[model samples]
Target: MLNRVLAVALAAGLVAGLAIAVLQHFTTTPLILAGEAFEKPAGHASLDPAAGLRFSGATIILAHSHGEGAHDEAGWSPTDGLERTAFTSLATVVTAIGFALILMAGLVLSGDPIDGRRALAWAAAAFIATGLAPALGLAPELPGSAAAPLLARQIWWMGTAVATAAALWLLIRTPGLWAKAAGLLLLLAPHVIGAPRPEVYASGAPAELAGAFAATSLVVNAALWASVAVAVGFFWQRFKPHAS
Candidate 1:
């Protein structure tokens, strides 16, 4: 079981991570670079510049896995695009591994045989739950943007992700009116409750750029999750025969 998990995770993570890293280089990373210009007073690069899916928060979570010192928001940053890009790639792979584990674990718990079609469905649901659900409440933020307390926002995002996933499971796996209604409520609950709100609406970056950042985060996440699902799904089946 352990070997199977590791195999699927590494495969999925590398494929998904590399893909998203490329996507962000062109899509979200530029926005972050632009936003950083407004963050520092010197108008030079900020210390510990931001990275992949910078708006979505995944990059930070994953980068820590590579090494505790990989990213230090407090430290001074050098103007090294190559280093930043390399780190971003590492972050993406690490993040993908974590998410792939979750995906594969869900399948194991469900006792379902893996296949491309089912994997696609799983990936879509995962994307909806983890990516879209939280995003609905908390769109990605740029530097210098007004926002809620970090802990509060994290709590809300987590709750939304869990609720959305539960709702999806209920709707897809269970039948009957009660199950359906419950699923619907779970789906709507978080949005109705709403995400953590900013205390004051403000940002150093232009409103347009901020909007672009948020939209790009959502789009990139959707694609990343979908691709991850497919890759993991393919490898899971391929690796299954050897797990025994």
Candidate 2:
């Protein structure tokens, strides 16, 4: 049974991760390349290394208002060539598979017979636990973006992920109002403590590009998580014991 569960999860992850990588090539990767262009001009490489940039509402509005250009993603560059695409695909697959296994374990702990439907729910929870929640404090950074102290960000990021995961597990699996309330508190605790922020914010990338990247990255992650969950769920259900 354990082997079967793992097999199903691995299959699901393989497919979803490939899909995400393809989507990212067209979506986030272009933005990433464009952001890199600004790196040299901004004197960012030699400047502050500990000031991570984040997307503000303004940058997204700017990106939407403009159309394609050099900074806005014009003709494809050699940077977005086959090699990069292949590497990205490989990395994404590994990441997705890891998450799928985590989700499977969570389902087991839920005391529910793993099924497609529950797998989907667990995926959603996992996303919240690992991605979106933690991102509340640390929006994805583009290359050359300033970052907070490495140690600080790492601590907060890990703590938030763990707290969020625990909260979700309690909320979903534990019975009773008190249990649910506890979950809600855990969910809020990390945020209350706040994510570590850079002493200052700076970026080589234009705000418009940075904003677009952050927004797109979040969207990409959302798709990746959902696809992995559904795929994992489907395969898990297919492998489960039939009604007898």
Candidate 3:
């Protein structure tokens, strides 16, 4: 069963990740490059070395928003064009694989028969938890955007995702009014606590461009999640007997 699950998830992740990478190259990449133009002029002081440019699977979720002082040559980054695309694609595929694994785990935990439709439902829920929930507080940001400290924002992001996931599970899996009420409160607690924010909400990017980038990023991420769902669902269905 474990082997079957891994097989399904790996295949699904590769397909979805490659698809998303292509979609992002066309959609979000242009916006990012445009935003970079608005970033601080080349001479600005570089920030922490640890936070330097890193192209990794977590980049999509953790650091999509490039903040001030984050674009120094002190750190290595994939050059624009083919190299950048290759790294981005690789990172996205790995990220998608992780997501697929988590989704499969959820199915296993629920002990429900997995199929494309069911996998999609799970993916939708996952999106709401990992994507939309945190985004409520921290909309997708662009290069040159004002942001709170990276560590603070990361802590909040992870908390929001976990809290939202737990709240969702409680709301959907448990019965009773109290449980439902608690779940609702849990869902709202993170927002109520508030997301970390910069002292000043400033950005070098034009307001219109920033807005467009945020919207586009969200849409692209949604597509990625949906793609993962479809792929995973198809593969799971194909290996249902082994999975069970």
Best by TM-score: 3
List of clashing residue pairs for candidate 3: none
**Cα lDDT tens digits for candidate 3, 120-152:** 889888999999999999999988688899999
Taking the tens digit of each residue's C-alpha lDDT, what string does model 1 give over 1-244? 7887789889988988898889989999999878765553222223334542232333332221233664563454433479878988888889888888887888778988777677678888998998887887888898767789999999999999999999999999998989989999999999998888976676657789999999998899888877788898788778876434
Off by over 4 Å in 3: 41-72, 240-244
Better of 2 and 3 by lDDT: 3
lDDT assessment of candidate 1: 0.78
**What TM-score would every model get versus the actual structure?**
0.81, 0.79, 0.85
Report the CA-based lDDT of candidate 2 relative to the real structure: 0.77
Winner by TM-score between candidate 2 and candidate 1:
1
lDDT of 2 by residue, 131-174 (tens): 89988889898876788889999999899989998888789778
How does residue 229 of candidate 2 score in lDDT? 80
Q: Model 2: number of clashes?
A: 5
Error of 2 at 172 (Å): 3.5
lDDT, model 1, position 162: 92
